[model samples]
Target chain A: MYLAKIHITHKASILDPQGEAIKNALHRLDYQDVSNITAGKYFETTLTSDSKEQAEATTRSICESLLANQNMETFLFTVEKVED
Target chain B: MYLAKIHITHKASILDPQGEAIKNALHRLDYQDVSNITAGKYFETTLTSDSKEQAEATTRSICESLLANQNMETFLFTVEKVED
Candidate 1:
């Protein structure tokens, strides 16, 4: 088995409303320290596969096909072996 | 400025419907390679802070107070100084 720790975020050019909302809210709460924020999805995936290479490939496929929008978002993940 | 990468995930005891749905979808698409997934939020936050210590502290506070649901979700983030 393998564990994939994935991080997905909007492209730098995109405007992230959720991140902006949180930033604005922090400012309202007197936390003017926070300036910029980009929010996205993180997935901790476990694959019951044979090899690390196969697990990594499947993870990338999932991220590209369903997890992220290629036009506006991007993703990176680390696949690690899970000791049974 | 400092960049904080935050990852939030549900507790192991929790049953994540979203993750399950995605897993089912992958199976239907014939990508039965995926077995388990725990989905959560990932945030790329840029904060204008003076010191690394301050940045780390603020990041933790944000994660604890606003980012993660303490009841069901747990969060971890890395704070790195950004080059101007």
Candidate 2:
């Protein structure tokens, strides 16, 4: 079995309201140097596959159909062997 | 300036319905090897500080106050120097 770490972030062109809110809050707190911050979702998924290629393919499918909104977000994943 | 990547995951004792749903979906798709998955939130924050220590401290305060739910989730952060 393999475990996949998926990181999803908004496309550079997309507007991220959540990130903006956090940014504003930071400024209010006097952290004036902070900028260009973005917030997104992280997923840890488990794959039931003996082959690395198969696991990767399965993870990709999940990310596309369920995990991410392709029009607004971009996702990347890394697969690792699960230790016994 | 520095960028921090924050990851928030449910504590081991918590029940994660989202992760459970995903796990069931994988099983329905015939991916039987998947198990023990948990979903989480990710944040990328920018800190306006000249010193690493100050930046880290600010990040911790943010995480504690507005980012993660201390009772149910655990958080970790990685700080890096942003390139011009």
Candidate 3:
């Protein structure tokens, strides 16, 4: 089996309120040095694929169709073998 | 500097609509054998510190105060030395 890890993030030009909120909270928590904490979505999937090409193709299609809003968000994924 | 990688996921018992949508999309993308896609949030923080304890404490405080919603989501993080 293969594991696909995906991340979706808003375009750099977009303002992310969730990220801003987290950044402010980090300061309150004493992490005063942290800045620009952009929050993004992560997804992990188990796939019954044997080849990296197949996994990538499948994951890309998924991202384009439903995993991300292509106009507003962009996504990237990594595929790896599941170790027993 | 240190790198903090944080992942926040909805409690396992909660129904994840985003995850379900991704699962369906994966199948349509020809990954018929894939299942159970869980979606979460990822945060990467660069700390201005040299001590592990300080990093951990700061990250934890950030999570508790703003990075995560304790009632609905839980988080885990890893700290690593950033390579120049």
Please report the candidate that would top TM-score against the real structure. Answer: 1
Q: What is the DockQ of each candidate?
A: 0.86, 0.69, 0.59
Each model's total of backbone clashes: 0, 2, 0
What is the TM-score (0 to 1) of candidate 1? 0.94
On the 0 to 100 scale, the lDDT of residue B57 in model 1 is 92
Alpha-carbon deviation at B29 in model 2, angstroms: 4.5
C-alpha lDDT (0 to 100) for residue B49 of candidate 2: 78
Tell me the lDDT of candidate 3: 0.80
Writing each residue's lDDT as its tens digit, candidate 2 over B27-78 gives: 7876676665689999998777788888898888888888889999999999
TM-scores of chain A across the candidates, in order, are: 0.95, 0.93, 0.85
On lDDT, the candidate that comes out on top is: 1
State each model's C-alpha RMSD to the native: 1.2, 1.7, 3.1
Ranking by DockQ: 1, 2, 3
TM-score of candidate 3 relative to the true fold:
0.77
Instruction: Give the per-residue lDDT of model 1 (tens digit) for B9-77.
Output: 999898899999988988887787688888899988888889989999999998888989999998989
**Predicted structure with the largest DockQ when compared to the true one:** 1
Which docking band does candidate 2 fall into? Answer: medium
> What's each prediction's TM-score?
0.94, 0.91, 0.77
For model 1, state the Cα shift of residue B80 in Å.
1.4
